[model samples]
Target: MTCTLENHRAELASLLKPVFDSLGTQWLPVTSEQLCDRITSEDTFAVLPIPAFTNSQMDGYAVRSADLLSAAPDAPVSLPLGFTAAAGDPQLELQPGTASPVMTGAMIPAGADTVIPVEESATGTFPELVRCGHGTPSGQAAFTAPSPEGRFIRPAGVDLAAGALVAPAGTRLAPAMIAALASSGLTEIPVRRALKVALCTTGDELSNGQLAEGQIPDANSPMLAALLRRHQVEVRTIQLPDDPQGFVAAIDELQAEVDLIVTVGGISAGAYEVVRQALSPLGGNFHHVAIQPGGPQGYAQLGDATVLCFPGNPVSALLSAELFLVPLLREFNGLPEPRPGHYPLAAEASSPEHKHQVRRALIRDGQVTILDPGSHLVHDLARADALVHIPVGVTQLVAGQSIETWSMNV
Candidate 1:
């Protein structure tokens, strides 16, 4: 059936829907270790902590704040040194009428209520011993300054109780996420498997050997394969000669193995449109959509597998893949919605008729700046960092009117 571009996109999406929905339960569930091969997400992960009692905010005397209540500069309280504590050292418990020397992060032992700064103590000097001299307030300090219970200590489970969903699902496992996952004791991730797709771009014109008249080297097959793998699709590519019997025989051998099949060319109206003709025997259709570069696109079915066919022109082939193939791959992979960047509209190409105008562009400052890869000039596509879609006829982008664009991950 002939489909308008929008209708085709909808149909394409609909066609692949069941493939995902009916994905049978895996015979063997995948583990995190197995996912290292294909799982790739850019999602943020939560923090994984290594437990420790951190140092106090400053170097100070460990005492009950109350002991220092009456301790002013002139009559600075001098608590006898009961014990001393430093970061990463043993907790020091102080006795009544005395204080312990403590550094930042030292554990507060039993009977200590608060930490008074060393500055508040007679020994305000740092890097020195806790000097509790003979006349120091060894006997009076505890009675004067006291702190409330649990003042400076971070009680266990205060931040996050263990087993409290430390690592939530849907987080893109990254390096930091690796820590969280490791902390969660997950050595392997359970993720969707890499989709396997097969490709066979057909044309009599394509060859690596010396070219004859009207023949051009095949760029679409290799290029498409490269493009597919870049976005994480595990692709198997085959180049077929233009002969109808040869193509049909090739497909007959491929259908049972692939989940999806994408053909590069020969689905157009021309006499040599072998794919449209040969696949018609096995069910494939090539018809015009309301799209320019990808006007002649098609789809077909071979038993359990489906084929998405694109025009021979590299631009057309790529554009068709972007619009049709990407959504399908994403659906198959169970990935989040594709994130597209935007560039400013550079060229003055606008369609007042309001049909989706798919153009090439470079994304800059979160906008898609337009650049037309003149329908015939497929090479121009190489210069583009993104693809901008000026959807259907709202003509005239006066140098900088914001238009929605679909940015590819090129």
Candidate 2:
């Protein structure tokens, strides 16, 4: 039976739930220093406030905001220079009516409530107390009028409070997230274990040395592997010929090793459709989805592994993976759901009468231009950054009309 796009996805999710649930929630301690792209299994709380202590946000003087209350740039207030508060200095205090030189990120002195950048002061340079003025209250520095209380002073907890929920569960930690965690003194983090998948490409042309005879090389394996790797999924790729026994044997060998098996080719209506023949007897659900380029699709439960099959054409296989597999894998890996974006068509485009046409598109500056309409040009797909999806029954999409799109780079 034919299935709609959502029907197939829902079915796949239901069929794969048992397998994914069996894997359970396993977490590994990942070193925070190298945890980029790791998915968090649980919400992360800030153990301590980011910054931990109040600090200066500029290289200037740390003084009580009151000292420069009435000061002006033309007629500046002069005050005695106190000690320098460099970064990492511990427990220093600003003297009353005095200005203490502070480097950026230096802890704000106990009595200081404001930081005036050196450039805003009469003396643009950080003063050397010994050489500039020697000693006494007579040694003074000019400052701009204090803008307000807490000026240029990054208060403790300004960024994140202690015990605050910094990252919700399912967050994929990037550089900024790592920095925030590090600032809260996190040395290691609990990240979800990577999902293992087997990528199978079936075609007699690819299995043997037929490239010299004008046969297509195996491009789906590398492309699919890279796509899976981008989301931190471990992939094992295998290339097999158009033989039912070989396909069954390949599936048997990999079912126990991977969480999912994705096969490229041999699922269409053609005579040499080895994958369809091999899996259909074992109760694989194969159908023509209401989508172009990737109409022929199949899914099966083989022992412990879940299998997803795509059509053999290079563009078709990639489109299938981008539309169906990527989002599924991302959801299982605790990443955010793929967002469907809309952009105006840069030029006129046409779609198939009954099927939802997904055309390779180049989206730029809020406009999407179809790269290959009603064609399976792999080069055009390469130039595309997104796929323009025209809904069924709408054959014509005029220039400047909004079209729904899925980003390929994601």
Candidate 3:
């Protein structure tokens, strides 16, 4: 009997519950330098405020806003230079009626609440040297304009404050997050443990090399392996014979090592389906799903491991992974949920009457265009950046009609 695609997905998820639950608190420490692409397991806080102190945002003079309140284009104010401050210079108080030259990122001196850019002064450039030895420069710097208080000053804690929540739990660490963590004085991160998966391909007619007249090369195992490994899931590929005993042995060997077992092929109604024949007694519920190119799907519990079964066709196996297995694995690892989008079809397409059909598509300029070589043909899938979903009961999709699409980028 055929099950709705959603029901089948939920059933498969239920079978893998134990593995998914184990990942909630399972975490490991990753240093900031190695945090890229890792999924955070807990919220991280800033130890210190970003910038830590008010600083100058421009290479100019630090002055009190009151000093330049009356300064204008026709009547500019002139003040004796108090000192010159480059980035990292020790903080010094600004003497009254005097201005200090401060470079970008230099701490704003006490008693100063504004910055006058060097170009806005009569000097038209930064001072070559600053005398902080109680003697002022011979010529005074004229501020030709007036700016509001706090202008060009980066106040303390403006970007981030101490103890601020920076990265919340379950965030995938990217370059920006890593930089934020580092700037917040964090050196290490707690990240979810990488998932481990076992890949097994079953068939008597499968080969890795040049095929004899009736033999087909095994494409499912390698494709699934790459897809899983790309997401940091550890994958071990197992070759299973058409013999039921061999298939059982292979699964038994990998039972203790992997969190989940994904098998491609031999679960359909055909007589030579070795996976179903061997594991049927173990409670594997082989059934068809209301989805085209990936209708035949099943899952079963063997001892402590969960085995997810996909159909023999390359497109079906890969599409099953993208549509069902990968999403579950991503959720199990604390990754954000996938958000499929809807786009207008660039051309007309047909859908199966009862099953949800997925066409490999390219989304360009807000429209989705289907690719050729169809479902059984595997090579053209590489060029597709997305999968356009045509739901059950929808017979045809006219050009310019909008349909849901799943991105294959991740």
* lDDT of model number 1: 0.64
- Largest lDDT belongs to which candidate? 3
Q: Who wins the TM-score comparison?
A: 3
Give the winner by lDDT: 1 or 2.
2
lDDT of 1 by residue, 1-410 (tens): 44567789887887777654544322112234434323333222323322333345456666665566675555556666665676766665567766676776777755777776656445446433543232333222222244454555554445444445544433343456555555544444544445668888788778766999998887787778887775556689888778888888888788777777888888877888888888887777667877667878888877787788888888888888878877666555544675654445554666535355677777766655667646666567877766666556565676666666555644
Which candidate model has the greater TM-score, 1 or 2?
2
Whole-model Cα lDDT per candidate?
A: 0.64, 0.80, 0.82
Where is the poorest 10-residue window by lDDT in model 3? 25-34
lDDT of 3 by residue, 296-387 (tens): 88888899778999997988889899878887777755556767898999998887789888888998999999876356878778778888
Task: List clashing residue pairs in candidate 2.
Answer: none
* Candidates sorted by lDDT, best first: 3, 2, 1
How does each model score on TM-score?
0.65, 0.78, 0.79
Tell how far residue 217 is off in model 1, in angstroms. Answer: 4.9
Backbone N/Cα/C clashes per model: 35, 0, 0
